[model samples]
Target: MPYLPARAVATLRLLFATLLLAPLAAQAQAEPDGDNSQSPYFSVHSDDPANDRLPLKSTQVRARVLGVIADVTVTQHYRNEGSRPLEAQYVFPASTRAAVYAMQVRIGERQLNASIREKQQAKQEYEAGKLAGKTSALLEQHRENVFQMNVANILPGDEVAVELHYTELLVPTDGVYRFVFPTVVGPRYNGALATGSGTAEPWIATPYQCTAATTDAVGAAAIDESAPVFDLQVQLATPTPVRELVSPSHAIDIDKGADNQSRVRLAAATTIANDRDFILDYRLAGDRIESGLLLSKGSEENFFLALVAPPKAAPSQLIVPREYLFVVDISGSMHGFPLDTAKVLLQRLLAGLRPSDRFNVMLFSGSSSLLAPDSQPANADNIARALTLLDTEMGSGGTELLPALRQALAVPGDQERARSFVVITDGFVTVERDAFELVRKHLDQANLFAFGIGSSVNRQLIEGLARAGQGEPFVVLDKASAAEQAERFRRMIDAPLLTHVQARFEGLDTYEVEPPALPDLFAQRPLVLFGKWRGEAKGRLLIEGQQAGGAYRVELPIRADQAQAENQALALLWARHRVASLTDQETLEGDFAYSQAILDLGLKYHLLTPYTSFVAVDEVVRTAPGTSPAATPQPLPLPQGVSPLAVSPLTVGAAVPSTPEPSTWAMLLIAALGGLLLHRRGPRGAGGTV
Candidate 1:
């Protein structure tokens, strides 16, 4: 200190003071109103006024269920209410495994069907159509579950309707079937986004509806008239009586039609905003999941799907000690309601741990922190201490997930105990592909289970993590459902229903089975297999497994006469599952080995894939001779129960950043210290001042 002159000392003190107050100043500016904080706090207004900015009016969904297969069609109506010609772009979600095979657009009375084309080719065609003053609609897949729709040239007072058709096979678990219709695409946090990075996801640039000024008791934003109205109806048909049919997400009215048929629709009195996921669950009479074969004989190809029921979980007397690492998200998105729900879930999860298990908790946001240096015993004292520490986190900052994941995997552990990583979050980050690859590379170390803790979580990331790690995905739509979901997860982890599974083809000639090797049946989900059959379907399929320390076998006979045209979805379903497998393989072996194969599959099947898209163009010009349509990205509603903190409107075109946030004043101090150290250590010129 004595070596420094009075001038240098004063300069250092002034610099330190500025550094200490910088974040405090920023905090004041960010939350000036205390309710809404827009990052990069500026709004971009279109040339048109707010009244005409939104062209999308309504969306209608209809689903028909044939036993376990569901065919769904979603129709979106875009109306040009204002005087200007408009182009509307909407980003939405779908089931991760949905096979979108068709899309069509209707204008007045003329209807034009969309054609599946290579992604670049489709984009070119859509752009050409738009440039030619023609009406066009383009559908593209940005992620497995996320999609974007672009409709061009809607003249004044003209209403154009676009319908997308897809099919998904509903696999039941624990004799309970679930059908999920994702309604909104939550804002994504892109860690790689930077100026000149060029790799930023364009979809994240879209706008989201803001209603933080008023929040309901459940912390859901109030729906304004600008939101599109949604209507959903499901025709459920089963081979046996459907019992306990219910929807945990929406209030519905059910009408029993036939002996095994039911019509379900959203109650007219209920709110119709598409702000959260629509989920339906049901069980067959006697809670029995049928084990059978579905045969689809196409003119060119023959496909078959098999489902073999696994035995119920047997209570185990011998318990094995295990290691559990719980990864939790405490980001700004979890600031209010979401954070509360996560706390409740973690409480239940920690309390339910077995006394023999060793457990630890890792809370992550911009950075990660561990409850302890190493795994702690699941004792009352440790549990209380851990919970107390977790309770202090109020949830702030960006969601930097990969660093936390790497840290969790790097921890040294005992190889003898079975290990599992449980992650709980809203799954809102854009680094899902990287996360999946990370989990896939470490499968030898432990399995990963993901719990999405919001009304409209990113199912793609949650399910992908589980899929990559050979575990399962769970969602807690709200706080009320957290306890039930947590209990189910704990039970599933402890009980293995079947093991040592093997499937063999007999007289039936089968080829190219999607999953060549089957995993041990931990939950009550059936062993499902997809393949192509040749010659005839008359054969016996045999499967063997171990249950409760005893050998178990099941054989199902397939008859050639049982082939049905109603099972036409099987061929497309097989292709979708194959694409998924190839995708996983592509991630594992990085050079895109399966790229061409996936492209060929998409082209051959005319299905929507990462490599292909659907585009529809009306030949006739829609806009006037001189006027051009204004392109408007549709604003999506804040997924129900999500806080405004999640969608910070943080970046160029409204995307969130993936950097450490000024969560506390201490962060400012740390930054100041860093600057101070750098200043003192930096090299000086020969004639250094003072």
Candidate 2:
């Protein structure tokens, strides 16, 4: 966090091709655990040496979340080894219901957090009578959409195993069930899609494999591979057309039947090779919200199943009270455009604060300070004072985030009101775990929101912290993103339209479906949900909200396959917000299920996933003399200052290529050795040999 002098900054900028962005890794260190024999630590790495961090080996894990129950089992192996008992710290990417529950941690008899088992027992006993065939009103409240962990204490030479359990509520939704996972971004796993439907149970799973391409003399070459693709089969009660769109792969196949029914298939492709994530966008779209619902008719294990629905009335706005704390980093890194932009945004945020709302600003660097001595009702004088502080000489120093967070949490407010802390930073350090843990400790009262600045900041850290805080993380990719985020922030802070919202569907005994948890209603946006629906006839649909004083409920009429477009749009907006919020919370579900589907579709339709290659591999696999015989594999260019074992983003989702020894350097060294030997002998024999 040290701020380089102005001249130093300029000189460094001139000397390096890129600005002095944040370093991606932290130096390893040992800390004391209560147990002397066991100590555990966690670190992240990337194969991209340019990143300069420990590479995160690609892993496939199993995870699930439901009402009050959260579980994750990592099939991946741990590589840490030592003779003493090591404190294993599992890092959770976001906040979850597990935090409040006793998490059962098992790594071969070293039970770290067994209190989780007790919590589960208590939950089961608490709901023994009404547990079956019932959903809780507070169900969604317990569900965390993002999960990351840190384990402490482990013995040396012992194989590490991981299992976590907690509880959460699944909010019911009216829209299609959608899940997203990021394998990598923008490149390798580019433009992938998958689609299928089933009844009874819903699940999506994908197995990922990694590999590389073969080439010749030049440093560049085309990557090609052929592997077994997973099978994708879904049974439909009626004819339903499935369409997939993937990058590095494109297709258009239209089908029509004599019955006058029509189905359209679409796909696309891209050129960049990167270890990008696969995004799954699925929904049952039709002319209306009702009727067009398709139910699961195949095996009960299909991941997606739709059923008949109803119409939703237009939503009304309600007022929600808020207590906010703004945390700003005024380190030397912010001396340039970063600081200026932050000032403007702060001003906008202050302007949007209401007189009834409570707020404070905590600016940190080498030290932390508040805008005022205590929390103040937003007013002209206080707002002006906060802005004035921003204009003062802000110096750069080492980032001490813990103290700043402690100060922000110390701000007092009504516990019932929605509390929030917004952190703004360029995210340029390695204190990811400590900072996030601090936020986690005080998350019960305030939601943490983050606005990440800079082009090369560690998004994982920024987004991870926000997720842990049950807050939203905004990225300022540039001016455009900054402006857009500012506006979004303004809207979120304006007011809450509703609180503790709920939807109840009456009349329909033969139906089977689950909905997303109802979310906290925000005035800035509407609420939307996606879920499954089934069977005939329904009664009146009811929507309820808890206001500051009284409860509000509205009853709407039902239809078969038709959905109200206006209501659906509002729901879409709500859905987007909920997903973003879950991502920030790191409790959102992973995209593995959807990713598997995309990979399958990519393979069947020749699409590209981190695991699926879009380029034609048929010829490469059929290596014939006529066809370019697997061109003699050439060595990949080694990055300077990087080790041969470094993971390459290009190689993610594929097999690792064998590295060849440096041929030119080896030849030169050998030739030098031979000449030295000859010279030594000649010197010794000289005239005698002649």
Candidate 3:
């Protein structure tokens, strides 16, 4: 062997050490198997070895639809199987439009109603309660659609139940009313953990748990045997007879009763995993669209909700050349069903394009690539090329959407041609506000439509993108509905029912109307409005807009005396909407006043928000003060239709190395050091070498 110089020898030793440790490090970070279960990413760990994991026991969902509004209640049961006390934390998802109003905590025979407080105040209260050895629970909103529930100081063998209630309005799309209830919060990809505490989002710091199985069967079975089962039921009360009732996501049993009422529940013995959203869709008899006003009276203030239908539009005689830009997400989260759905939707949309129109396709994952530098003519050749590009170049990577969106917006287009930008994705991104701001900034350039594809797509991002883009949001949970969804999208954009719409109140003391300015009406969906009014309820609410032929106007008489006390839900719903609008504005303006307003509104209406939280406590001491309760994270189910491999390191049941054993690097370093020492010692342990 050639004699190596001292510097070279040192360098080689270091390189060898690195090579030995690299794989060891990776394996060490691998997810754990069921035999040695551990928390995945974005989870907090407990100190007590016995209280390592807190398993969710069960989830029950009940929904009641009265007219066009739905009141939903969800109950989650958690059990502490360990010997020591533990603090359980769970991160979950909900509908974007849901107006959460109440939360309750049940411990054995005692039920505690949570009270909403400013976020910081609630956190302080929860910590104090924990320190005082009291049992407590806290509910906080992490994102518009994501929430966190924390239960502190649950004694061993205790089964605690958390109940949450929310209400939302049902806006029919294409004459069909759809209700979505999301069950799982998909694992978020965080490149690195947060450096400091007290960050705005604490759940991001929770550690992640990797499981050993990826397939549906193995994944479902690999979960803790104590994991919770789900039970869901819905009572639908519509004024008109339902022509059909269906649940594409779940096997459901529907019982139709007299008076246009029906009851729906999950089919018997149906093994439902909390991996997919539960969707219920119904069509009314004759497919008629009805619009009306709802009023509610309170001791202090009065509220009103109005839905106005626009006149049907006639077929356009003038053919307008338009430019269409399609943005598709090829992120790892959208590997299987979501990507397939996008492809099917895009094909249908491309086929419907007129020859006079121009289109381009942009696929993005970690980076973006456009089919052409500019928009291409919608001819057979370009369409074929686009399809081929989709086939060859579409692959999964990190979800870097902002850059792709920026590139799409920067693509120069023909000034005279109308522009419509369609975005297809599972919306698995946390930077929703940034995306919305970008769309809002480019509203003058193109009309933005968002298509959310997946069993439990991010509705907040989808709806926000459309609202900012001045268009509509469409969701397709299954591939079978792609064609119908595409057709609906085409019809919605092809004609405008009304434009430049404005609402005016005469002889009414109306104030704080949400969505101060209305966008053009594209479909038969109602124009919904929520506002506060004073004085006698006798006033004329006038809606004005320009139709195909001329100006259009409709007036509805409002009577304050008709306000019913039972409609208190209207007030809470309106407050929630106002808070959402204010939060969006706050995100854009970075104003503290908007933040304060949201906090005040949340406290007033008892709504959980980013600036507010719900907290409940029991007076009795549960755990000792010096002995801290272990912080246990609850694992969420893998979303339906999402492959286990799609999640990689976060796979539900996949066996992954949590930590690597001692690597060869130690041996290499030891050998290298020993060689250097022997070289220094020379022959026979003498100082000098011959």
* Ranked candidates, highest lDDT first: 1, 3, 2
Task: Say which candidate scores most in TM-score.
Answer: 1
What's the TM-score of every candidate structure?
Answer: 0.88, 0.40, 0.85
How does residue 189 of candidate 2 score in lDDT?
9
Identify the superior model by lDDT, candidate 1 or candidate 3.
1
Kindly list the per-residue Cα lDDT of model 2 for residues 365-470, writing each as its tens digit.
Answer: 6568887776778889988988898776333443456667777787776776778888987654434545676778776787788886543344655766875775
Model 1 alpha-carbon miss at residue 97, Å? 1.5
lDDT digits (tens) for residues 245-325 of candidate 3: 998887899988999899999885434456778889999998877768888777898899998876876676567899999
Cα lDDT for residue 622, candidate 2: 12
lDDT for every model? 0.82, 0.39, 0.77
Over 72-189, each residue of candidate 1 has an lDDT whose tens digit, in order, gives: 9999999988777788989899999899999999999999999999999999999889888899999999999999999999888899999999999999987899999999988766
* Decoy 3 TM-score against native: 0.85
The model with the greatest lDDT is 1
Q: Per model, state how many residue pairs clash.
A: 0, 105, 27
lDDT of candidate 3 at residue 222, scale 0 to 100:
38
